[model samples]
Target chain A: MSLLSRKIADAVSAHPQKGALTVDDDRYEICLELRSADPEIGVSFDGLDFRALDASPRSVETLKAWGERLASRLTYLMEPLVVLEVDRIGTEVELRSAKPSVRESQLRYYELRLESSGAAHLRRVLFDRDTRTRSTVPCTLGAEALERLVEDFTATAA
Target chain B: MRKIESDQNRFRQIVRGKIKSDLRKYITHGEMIGKTGGELVSIPLPQIQIPEFRYGQKNGGGVGQGPGDVGTPIGRSGEGDEPGAAGDAPGQHLLEVELTLDELAEILGEGLALPRIQPKGRANIIEEKDKYTGIRQTGPESLRHFKRTYKKALRRQIASNTYNRNDPIVIPIREDKLYRSWNPIPLPHSNAVVLYLMDVSGSMTDDQKEIVRIEAFWIDTWLRSQYDGVTTRYIIHDAVAREVDQHTFYHTRESGGTRISSAYQLANKIIDAEHPPIDWNIYVLHFSDGDNWGEDNRQCVSLLRDEILPKSNLFGYGQVESPYGSGEFFRELEEAFEDVPNLALSEIRNKDGIFDSIKEFLGRGR
Candidate 1:
């Protein structure tokens, strides 16, 4: 394999969750959510599709499946995945977990947020780890609203 | 196939002609902005019909040999007509042609007579890039220099006294292989900073906000295309100045008296702290309804003349006319910066005036 492909493969192996990527900018709005495994809450980028990125990752099968379902809904790709990583130390996901944690740069920003709680809430919704930028208002939407929007879009896509 | 391709090109030319003739109308009405995907933008190209050479029916008495009665409906069977019920003369057939965004931008640039921005900062930034430094005796032909290799082999053969005139077999030794060289130098790229200041006062209606939103998108598109890495900052003010997100800048509704100077102050502060004139080319664009506090005009004028204009590459004041606005500020700006080189002022009367205003603001190409 070429060096670039090898590196990308390595990255995929190291990371969890990946999906298809589609490129379309027709009428679409991406709705994101912040939640943990316990709550099971998720968000959506309404009208955007992602079937193309389905096989890019190695170990992130679960993430890939979610991406598959999400990709099935839309006919176009809107934006590339903006990611954030929650480190083991102070991540919302880490904090919520039962296991003990240690020092590490686990939390990285896909998008930054206003407060820690809000940032945690955003990370959970967007399912990304890190928060970036100067303190800015975190995007807010109710769990029900997120699900409703996603479900409505999923129905239309079907 | 080549003829068909040429015909296709002619059709596209017709589509572009239609667009150019009514470019201002399209910009104003926000038509032809429907985007499809990369390399394809859906445009409502009007009245430009697809090329069709309809053959006459075999039995019809058409121009060439046919068997039917004299002039028995020369064309295709029938596009059925019910002659009445508010008669239908051939309805305008608008073909939606998908032109690349670059084509659209080029057309817009030509129609508006906008001067291309001369790139500035690219020459100054000390970018250290590695290129093949210089020729060497042995490297790879992906980097090979044939002349250098021949010269090296000839010189080596000559220097070592292996020169023979009878049989000139100057075979290149392993050491004779040479490679071309490259050097890394710092390249400069011009930088531009765009400061968008808007009035979030009560007088500015949602319609006005929508106008600003749409105009800003096109302005950004054109300006970003003009300059690499264009720095954009949003400042909104009602009675005071504050920074806001992209979403809030357009959607945030506030109800306070107008104080145009507040936005100016914030913009000036941003300029002072982040973008100095030496390192950055600054552009300040202010969108306001001319309803400033009567006493603040002098302060605004002084600021524009002294601090803002000096530091800015272009200081554009767009006075959006609103129902409640006195619109006195536009007149004041006209009188104040009448001969100013980089300062441009445009009056946006309504949605229809957006194209003209954009042209007026960026036409000088400062």
Candidate 2:
């Protein structure tokens, strides 16, 4: 295992939400967002509120190794998600997901806006198929909020 | 415009994905070499499906809005129709997409998880360059700024109250012309030179040459992306070594015996005369069948230890497997200099081995 993978695994294992919370019939996915300066790790449940945590790097090699490891982790995490979206913020990896209720016809997408100070804000939106209209949804839902939203949306949409 | 840009970006992403997925196949094949241009390579991708509005058959189809007789020909048949076995599958269409060498290198690095090369020994050289800094009033017509000249003419006409709303034409006079001016600026640029030495002895078959050619193309692509200016020199050796053009480097066949020291000697001379160790990042890559004169092995090792390895950023030895040649050179190099930092060695047994050979040669990020 590379240093970056070790660090990411350590961070994920030490997080308060580690294996303790489940939302939308899936476990919370942990991600490490890398940057050229002052890199951080982020964790999200439903592609929102990617909480950034602090990290330290020994050199550029560690950063590059971290990126490769993070990509592998993201690929593994995406295997079970209904919708997977991967983007980059500078040198960082931004992963977003949606519940299975949001079908492909809904044209769902997510974006993360990273400020200069290294804070990230995630937004998710879906388009209506019949009306050709777009509507934004609050993506920063916690475990309880995500569970309720997924249950309600699944029940109502079905 | 935004929609078109978004579509273009999406298409580029799809192309990248296709290239990444078939990277190993591409590394082993030399089809893209013929399509390469100065800084861009055209890759033929057969798997990318072009999206189009495929029309379906209309219900109750008739020529004149009425039902036609069954088994009746409505249109004339072409003359080329002949009795042959039918193919139920749709024909495949290949799309040739142009990608800059930088983009290709990025994909190679990401796909192989290759580390970024940290250039050693005076990575940068300062060169004077001309930059178009600002506009001037008098210069050659080739340097004339059309938009600036038109704007100047318009401003002059408006200031003199000679603007015509009817014609709406502002002709620029000599005084209103603007020309681009340049200034000499000193720029630091990273320059690299690749020394490609290949064994073209009787034992090295055409298949081995083809493998060397394919691997060289990809290595050149990746290295060229890292440096500002990359110069490639080709040397083909049997018993005697001689410099050759890129075309002759891969196609030539020699009947003489093998002597690895000749190529190294010529490479050393070339570096000492032209590419000095203090000014350029040098990469020395040699492809052979791991066969050499029994006595020359010690000379080759001594030359590498004394002259080549110290001056080179990387010294890569790729032993292409051949049935006619005894593969002993790689074992000698490994036994002598296995722990060297800049020396990278790999055994390429066939086309499939080119992928791993590339990884071994460039994995260290030298």
Candidate 3:
């Protein structure tokens, strides 16, 4: 569903942890900035005022209306830029064509990013969603280790 | 018979699809592991159920119609002459399917598109084992041949001129006993060892360790596929590090300061004592939340450069992004070892990035 920009603001305000939250599929690139409490993440994507989403009572309803149209309009078939942002901690997921490569549906490039908290939540969702596709791949180290911030990424051995 | 075989094959295909659809839950959820045993695993699949006849008399006219159907209730034949047992509940059934580990692995490979590992290093420790294969007069009683022992006893009794045709009873002394024997030959096999080093300081959380655990299992699976014999070692570290079993590796939590060097020292010690670079193909994978005591960061780099790198075939370092982590360790490694050939470093920002991280680290076939 298309919350477009407002859902992200609601997700961020609900939790101060950039890594702990993100609007599902709301994508971003978190630039690393040196800070006092370890390193903090700064996001790059649509800017929706965080204050307004919390203040407006009709935010969810408005988001639903806008998202429905947007979901229909934004076609992945055209090689659209897919940016996924999760409001759990902070993770920016972007899938796009790598440079100089011509656009072909099957040959397009893909990139994924997960802020720690956001990724942990995403794992629960994605791993659950993995039920839909029925993947044939073994959950091997290289593929699994590639997963982000999963606290129990090492669970099977346990 | 051919039709039945074809139907069974189609049923198996359906079961495979069901498994593939839920593969992620199966991977992430750990319930399936308990079900694994021997070479085959049983997975329960929900299926539709139907009732059928259990007894004879389909052709017998008087079987259900009470003697020749003349006064029988033939009016409601469309409704089925017999009054069946009534039940309101819908039929539900679960089908259990057995699959081998290799079959499971094949499905996994197809789903993930993982590259096969190319084994490296010189594995020269040839081993020889003997197995009981033939009957012999001299051998341990544990391997005694029952049929041969009886035959030899009977033959000895006859040879000693104590045989009787009417009372066919033959019993011989201990010398007539025969046992099984064995032959030994060298069997060459390749083996490997994986050393998993994890930084478990305050910066790292349980969530992060879970990720490491999942990744490690897959890593082990692929490596095991490459070599017949494989061993795994686990090391977890805080400001101080220690070598522990796999269980302790994921569960232990410490919160003082971070010293990446401690884990390396312990790993180096393990390699020196148990595995030699000449004998085993060693793969070292280090997962950290990317926080190291500033002064000790340099020490960690020194340890990797001087001690760890030389003894390992692939030295993989993954920086797990965390809220409480400094995240500068990855940058430091990038700056320090920009062109190191065997050094594989990756930045894991979240779970989705795991896919690419694995590709980048193992893509070179190390």
Candidate 3 lDDT tens digits, A5-103: 334333333424323232322232122111111112323221111112222233322333322333333333223223222111111122222221222
lDDT by residue (A1-158, candidate 2, tens digit) is 32333334344444544232222222212232211111133345333332223322123333233333333333222222211111111222232342223565454545333322223344565555445344565333333333333232223211
**What lDDT does model 1 reach?**
0.60
Residue-wise C-alpha lDDT for candidate 1, range B112-155, written one tens digit per residue:
88898765544235567777778876566688988888888889
Off by over 4 Å in 2: A1-158, B54-91, B121-126, B131-181, B185-190
> What is the TM-score (0 to 1) of chain A in model 2?
0.30
- Error in Å for residue B153 of model 1: 28
Superposed model 1: Cα runs more than 4 Å off: A1-158, B1-5, B31-40, B53-94, B123-190
The per-candidate TM-score of the B chain, in the order shown, comes to 0.71, 0.77, 0.70
Top-DockQ candidate index: 3
How displaced is residue B99 in candidate 2, in Å? 1.6
Interface root mean square deviation per prediction: 23.5, 27.7, 15.9
Candidate 2, clashing residue pairs?
A: none
Per-residue lDDT of A75-154 in model 1, one digit per residue for the tens? 22222122112221122111111111221422212221111222112222121112211121233333344334334333
TM per model?
0.52, 0.55, 0.52
Q: Relative to the true structure, how large is the alpha-carbon lDDT of every model?
A: 0.60, 0.69, 0.57
- lDDT at B10, model 1: 88
Q: With candidate 1 superimposed using the best TM-score fit, by how many Å does residue B40's alpha carbon deviate from the native? A: 5.3
